[model samples]
Target: MGAEYGQEGLVSTSCDIYSFGIMMMEVFTSKKPTDEMFTSDLSLSHWVSKALVNGVTQAMDSRLIRKDEENFFAEVNCVSSIFELALNCTAESPENRINIKDALAFLQKIRLEFLVKLSEN
Candidate 1:
């Protein structure tokens, strides 16, 4: 369930989107929502958002960076876009959250851009 579902008791597709966003964050950052570091003010989402302000390298999984040193720029760009998408999906307002169709489209675009950059390197 999402913030809207928990707060308003409303069940909708947005709830699933929120879950997806959280899952994305977890996969990218290797941090679970229930991690000891997360608190009321500092959530997994907030942690990622703040880390991104410095650099995606600070927020992303270390294994990814270590494995793709040659394509670090493209990898960072793709991960940053992914985190942005996750933030949008996890918006507090259900109406403000992105739909599945849009999310898929955005992800596809990110993938294509990443591939292009990878090929250029």
Candidate 2:
């Protein structure tokens, strides 16, 4: 019942890599990745990439904004790097992408850096 891609057909590992990337993007942006929002080739990934290039504030959901936000800009920058990683994992070509294990390791590094900064503050 599954569609074939080529000589190898379908591989579960690649699917999981793509899924991990999507999940990370969702957690960072808090947006659902349904195809409906991605009509006309405009996907959640696309929006996030555009937003990152423009400004992190523009990418963030308005609901998450606070009246007297102090660390908002810093947080946005942090999330932007994470977004970039997700984008790379979700690249069009599987050969151009990193696997789930690598993605997790990268995320953990980011988290550790974020924690160090928090402790310093």
Candidate 3:
């Protein structure tokens, strides 16, 4: 459940989007929101957000970093786009959050760009 869900006690599509964002972050960083390292001030979201300021490479899983060295720049761009989408999905205000359709379109665009980059290599 997201903060909005707890704060408002409302069930809506935005709630599901928030959960999806959390799952995407977990998949990328291999860190869960409930991890022992996460506290009230230092959460998984905060950690990733800080790392993203530096580069997506800093936020990504070590395994991905090792495997995608050939396409590092392209991969980082794609991952950064994905993280931005996740943040939008998890926005505190439901009205400000992106819907599933737009999220999917953004993801597809990222994928297409990645493929084009791969072909160029």
Candidate 4:
């Protein structure tokens, strides 16, 4: 599956995106990507999914040093958008996964937005 579906089929980019998404979630939560805490129907992806359904604020890692409302809102929006893209990249069906170029563009946009927001401060 890894070879045919992930490598030869040109799904490597999508698989990497899935992994990157998982990593981003871990970074935001300060938890291992596949820790036991996320077991029992509470996988990291599931938690993120629920949070996205409700609101991005609910998904933020409490450890992150949020400065103020402006920064907080900006961060929330950035993370939320990233998580949404990640979710799409990690869908069960290969056909549902997003291409790598799109993922890179999304991440770049997020980074640029953060930079702009920081500069405005």
Candidate 5:
């Protein structure tokens, strides 16, 4: 389920997209929606959004940070782009979200960019 669940109290394909976005965020951030830090309206997505204002490094899982790796910045940029897609998918309004087709296209572009960046190093 997604924000729509709270709004309309119904499950839908859009809701599935929202859920997929949430899972994507969770996988990259390594945080649960019910984490102790996510209390009082500070949901996982909200927290990630706030932390991302500082940098993608602050929003991603520590294990995935890889600050010392040769491609660290490239990796972070890739993850950040993915987060952007997740945010687009998890928009509060289902109608405002990126459709599955666009999301896939965006992801493919992100991957291609990441590979190009990796090749540069």
Candidate 6:
């Protein structure tokens, strides 16, 4: 459930977007909202938000670590954009979150950019 949906039982596209954002964060960060590192003040979203200021590497799953990979920089940039998108999707307010259509479009762009970068390597 999204923040609003979880708190107010308001079912809508926002809730589904929130769910998608959460899944993105979990999949990319390899950290669950209920992870031991997260507390009442710091959730997965919060963690990612903070970690991003430092660098995408901090928020990424260890398995994705590849500092020497041919497309490392592109991967970092793409994942960073994705983290930001997830954060937008998981906004505390439903009204502040992005729609699924926008999210999909953004992802398609990221995918294209990533593919181009990969090919360059």
Candidate 4, after superposition: displacement of residue 115 in Å? 3.6
Candidate 4 lDDT score at position 21: 70
Clashing pairs in 4: none
* Predicted structure 2: lDDT: 0.71
Residue lDDT tens for model 1, 19-115: 9999999999999999998898899988888877987778788977775478877888899999999998988788999999999999999999999
Say which prediction, candidate 2 or candidate 6, comes out ahead on lDDT. Answer: 6
Inter-residue clash pairs, candidate 1: none
Regions of model 3 farther than 4 Å from truth: none
Q: Write the per-residue lDDT of candidate 3 for residues 1-121, one digit (tens) a residue.
A: 6787798799999899988888899998888888898998897777778777976777788787665479878888788888888888888788888999999998899899989998998
Q: Give the alpha carbon lDDT tens digit for every residue of 31-82 in model 4.
A: 6755777777677777888889897667777767475666777777778887
Per-candidate local distance difference test: 0.90, 0.71, 0.84, 0.73, 0.87, 0.90
- The residue-by-residue lDDT of candidate 5 on 1-121, one tens digit each, is 6866887798888898888899899999998788898888788888778767888778799998677899989999999998889888888888988888998999999999999999999
Better of 4 and 6 by TM-score: 6
TM-score of each model, in listed order: 0.93, 0.76, 0.91, 0.73, 0.93, 0.94
Off by over 4 Å in 2: 1-9, 64-67
Q: How many backbone clashes does candidate 2 have?
A: 0
Candidate 6: regions farther than 4 A off: none
| Alpha carbon RMSD to native, model 3 | 1.5
Off by over 4 Å in 1: none
lDDT of 4 at 84: 83
**So what's the TM-score on candidate 4?**
0.73
Worst 10 residues of 2 by lDDT: 1-10
